[model samples]
Target: MTEHRHTNSSTGGTSPQLSQHKHEPSHRYSTGKECNASGSVTTPPRPSGIHQILCIPTGKIYIGSAVDLRARWGTHRWSLRRGTHHNFHLQHAWDKHGETNFEFSVLELVGTSDLLRTEQAWIDRTGCAARESGFNISNVAGSPGGIHAQEWKGFINPGGNEATIINLQKFCREHGLDFPSMHRLAMGKSKLKSYKGWTHRNSVRQREYIKTYDGFITPGGRPAGSITNLAAFCREHELDKTHMVAVAHGRICSHRGWTYATGKRKLAPRTYTGFINPGGQRMLITNLQAFCREHGLDIVHIHEIKSGQRKSHKGWTWREG
Candidate 1:
């Protein structure tokens, strides 16, 4: 039997492959006549802007944002297929339960900065199915407040407490964002407890853990034992606990995690700045040739030299290698 997955974005279908470039076309797909089939159209490039979510079968979900939903789902498709996202827990769940037990759905589309705000509000409010869909229900009610922006007194905030998947798609459409696809596993999470597993605290712990590993030393002098330990660390360090929660659990951590972990280059890959010749001297011909060879470029060629050009070709090189 063919396995199928669905996304809660604009395209309500199962994904086939993970494609990078956030805007590149995926090469593989299924030919079944499924509306959001495993394979149909070429992977649409993810657009720039907005928040998103992914619903899973186990009743557990992932809340996130993207400049491009298409690209994000594509990459996830690859990871899930490759068994990369399958950690010990997930693997065990799959073995005991099944892949069809979990499903992913998008909940909302907010400004990148607003993700934390909405997430915080959701965590604070802790009502409705907002976490499952990522939709800020205030937008549906015509609230004037921005996603995470502070609402002016008496102004109706667009992000309300009634977030849902359908509303999330509407929000994306209103904002011209590419909708994502839902991904479901055959099984459910081992445990399911609202406000217990995968809470804001867990999110914060994930971020703080990464930051700590990346050399961010909290004032506590070392990594704390757990979330409460983090609270203790923050207290000892005199950090603002509220803001710290936002920083630790917000979308910035997830986005930065992607930036730091994936992709070939750190930020901008290729760069070209004029060489810094040491000792205020011209480079030797052999040295230049060696440099070019190391860089896998063609050999040196005499293009042309202007008259009175004081170019040196000898004893003008220094190497620290």
Candidate 2:
């Protein structure tokens, strides 16, 4: 018998030259139907401009905002690989279909350097799918509005960083409607957490502090009640109290929950704070005068003091006296 042995490459001088190129399947199978089916329906790249339609498969129309049209699509492609797609609506559609089923097209690109403002306009116009987390989509930062139809349609002229009050003067002037009473506006909206009007914010501890702190000194240096026991106190004092105002720090009472509803304990007096007023950098003396005119009340009392040290003081000193 003749013995024959084959030498391996590791032993030395190549036994047989190994192919460096990748070995593919010798017989190619034609899944040409799959490619053709996907190809027949795949949408083409979209151009930039106003009023473009993106034929994103059935139940997947995502109207979006973008600075550059092509760049946005490129980002979507990368997002697919990284699997960090932020838009859940779009992702679900993509998962169900694939790249062929989706297309991104441009909608009116308002030429402005301000990308955020541009996006905000689109969001407001189209009502983006992921609006809650999307850029420039608005929600209540503080306070509330949109209870009435008129208020809902009209733009709220935010007065300060904290939107505690609506600018009724602007709303009236813009809409050509008679300036509504502050009380009406206050009554229109539900008490919100942003204003400390919610039951959760009106903790017993907060009421106790309001009741006892510096003896309920009003912001105007007059003695006021801690809404907890003000009315009974007034009734017992027999001072002929008519109306009262509780001026809280912009930060404190600005909590949406801290409303007249929450502030008015059964024993507490009716109280008005800056939150109840149309807020802005400047307080509307005209509005305040109007409120006083509308309501038959003499004394507008305040009930917050700003001293590091708490001291007892006589209540209800007349400003003129």
Candidate 3:
């Protein structure tokens, strides 16, 4: 498993070191519980932090950080195992060297706001982006201390006019809004899709492109009416739009006996297919991240809920389907 390799300095010089914290990821496979170099169980760091993936054979380390380290690590292992890791170099290395030669470890524990800047410092120190050195694709950090600095950004308001602005920095300055924060959301870097009712539009894709969509609801076996606004309908009659949308899209069984009237919803391919029990009520979750964001639930606990390790999250029972 884990090798307790220490370095002379923070910037690794000769061989890649992984014994930064008191532990090293020596588990032959990621089992939700992280094991130390000495084979003792060490819980994965909490809140947020930086992590490193080290290829011992080539001394190439992939530096990354996440809001949830365990979940992020699980994702990395999952992707790498599936041979679909975004980092081709890392995947190639794993395919060449074998999984046993690669070890993952904690670089530095950081808060959510400090992730990017701290990671940048590590990236600069390690030079992980060097072609022959590491597996980092880009040397540029996504954020600086969780605050972004970019110009000529674009944004679209989800609630208001769905019009796109060419330059968000200038627009925010003229309107006296936070540009850095908006820029993060607009660049699709942050988890939150909207900030202050504004959705960040990517330059490559118009994600804000909205076509007129409506749904019908049947309350107590009676047609309520053609609901033009799904969200407002959910709020007015004590329903979750996420569920209602799933019903309209024909993704789930039903959200309180509601279905699509036009019957084109099934054509919408993206659907919430995961099942979750929120507040002891079973509902279909089309997007796990979206559901977690809406309910303010931590992803780590959600994993536990599905695995039966956790009974409830924030007093709401969750079940796997």
List, residue by residue over 1-321, the lDDT tens digit for candidate 1.
Answer: 011222224332122122121222122223222224343544333442222222233333333335565566555445445544322233334445544443333333444554445444433343223534333333322232223223112111122122223333343345443222110100122122111112122122222332231323234444333343334444455555445554454423322222212213323332223232435544334444456567554333211121213232222222322
**Which parts of model 3 are misplaced by more than 4 Å?**
1-33, 37-40, 143-321
Sort by lDDT, best first. 3, 1, 2
How high is each candidate's TM-score?
A: 0.25, 0.24, 0.38
Cα RMSD (Å) per model?
Answer: 20.5, 26.0, 19.5
Error (Å) of candidate 3 at residue 132 is 1.0
lDDT of 2 by residue, 148-222 (tens): 213322222211122232444444445443333332334443233112211222222222222322234433545
lDDT of 3: 0.62
**Order of models, best TM-score first:** 3, 1, 2
Which pairs clash in the backbone of model 3? Answer: 2-26, 153-168, 272-286
Each candidate: what lDDT?
0.33, 0.32, 0.62
Query: Candidate 3's residue-wise lDDT over 119-216, tens digit each?
Result: 77778888888878888877876532112223443555544355655445446656655655566676667566465446655533334433344546
**Which regions in candidate 2 have their CA more than 4 angstroms from the true location?**
1-55, 130-321
